[model samples]
Target: MELRHLRCFLAVAEELHFARAAERLHVDQSPLSRTIKELEEELGTLLFARTTRSTRLTRAGRLFLERVPYVFTALDQARASVQDAAAGYHSQLRIALSDGISPERLSRLMALCRQDEPDVAIRFFEVPLAQQLKGLHEDLYDLGFAQSADVDDGILAVPAWSEPLRVAVPARHPLLAHKTIPLEEVLRYPLVMGDPEYCEGYCRQVDRILRSVDQVPLVTEQVKSLNLMMALVAAGYALGLAGASQIQTCRESGIVARPLDRKAVLTTWLLRPDAEAPESLERFVERVASLDAERRLTT
Candidate 1:
């Protein structure tokens, strides 16, 4: 019913223990318990099931937990909008990034936006692909970029740009003997891949490539970022697969990026709600298209 109720509910739902949640909230256990009880009575549902030894969320609690974080996100965005307005920004655009989008490309796009429209405040949120899609639908984000185009009906996905997928090899590794590594040879060694939960779009793209080969890959580890994957590859723990630009930007030493004998490309898509766009959004989309065109011309 109130902010405090939501806050207390979230704390307990996350901690799953009343005393621990109270400790986290810097409150006494009795008050925290009372707050939870008050919230439950108001909602007319049991949020948590507790026993002497354990506490866990009921079905209703789990469902409520799903929608609670968005409350805080909305509040934060509102605060940020006020701050941006005070800073003399006429408007704000919330853009979400998912699936470990290429930093070089994003920087170029952001620089272009700043140069073309200095009055517009561009805010970026790095979230998982699932969250990105949900935010787009909920109007939390105006647009998003990701490696996967797969989406539900309410969202539209269009290819913005693409880069070649390359294999990241450690220095002095046997695979480096070949200038262009074959897929079969790359799969023979263990690989460090992106975790699906964090990099769903990226994982989907990479998984499709891996599935093309008949042989099974030996994945040494699943990491959440390209930096970690490159680090593992640099250390000779395993090889890695990533976009060429991503491999080029990685500062880790002893990592060599080799192209595949066969061509493979990863495409980044611009995702937005499937509805009529405002003039500003239309201009932004045009800028994206022009940039991609320029890149193709120069490349």
Candidate 2:
């Protein structure tokens, strides 16, 4: 079918609600439904199983959804390739960053890339995990960095580096009395935490850690960035949790970072589309692995 059909199908599949999908596509529900019906007819298979109360993807729809992003990805790459050629760039690399990357490690990686591929221009996009995943599958990004291991089979996540998770407290906060704060005590204070929708992987890991302690976190504020979370913590608004790298690099005053007694940790991972990776991507991956090894040796 046409690209519109695929777009409509994807919207419906993701929203799982006819009205919402139609609104998202800025079209009426009837036309969207007809398009989906036509797609199913052309394929000779039902894509979605819809009820008045609930709509869900059928097996075929589920399978198609898994593959459709690649079609748009190919189109996007072609456009980007032509644009890059017109701009006189010899080569281009698009990378998506989610959660937050380690500044130290990322700097080393960039240095390696510049040394190894002097002619290649690099682009970085800070996006949500879901968007990054979509872009990766669609070929919009050559590589991605995120804190989650919840990738689909089409994407492989390699742990590039990890740092001990630390608790960020306002100076003189009761929790700071202990050199290492206990999980339950950290949860006792209201937390300024990462927004789950924005920092899905990191928040999910935090959730898992909190759940293990059977403590419900009283989140005072849900922030989209680590810097803001630290700011709030320093202001004595709430306690914050972050990796040691972030806490160490934070310039916010009145924030003391202490290790957790429970040894909570977060890992930043390198994600690549599970296809035959490009030569540049392969080299970058090797550099990342090498950096990890170097870090381990020095530490």
Per-model TM-score versus the true fold: 0.93, 0.73
Where is model 2 more than 4 Å wrong at Cα? 1-88
Tens digits of per-residue lDDT for model 2, 1-299: 89999999999999999999999999999999999999999999999898879999999999999779767766777787788788777888898999977776788889988898877877787888998998887677888999998998799999989988889999988887898888889888899989988999999888888898877889879999988998898899999989988888888989898998886889999999888977877888899999999989999
Q: Native-vs-model 1 lDDT? A: 0.92
Number of the top TM-score candidate: 1
TM-score of 2: 0.73
Please write out the lDDT profile of model 1 over residues 1-299, one tens digit for every residue: 89999999999999989888999999999999999999999999999999999999999999999889888889989999999999999988889999889999988988998999999998888899998999999999999999999998899999999999999999999888899999999988999999999999998888888888899999879999998999899888999999999999999989899999887999999999999977778888999999999999998
| lDDT values for all models | 0.92, 0.88
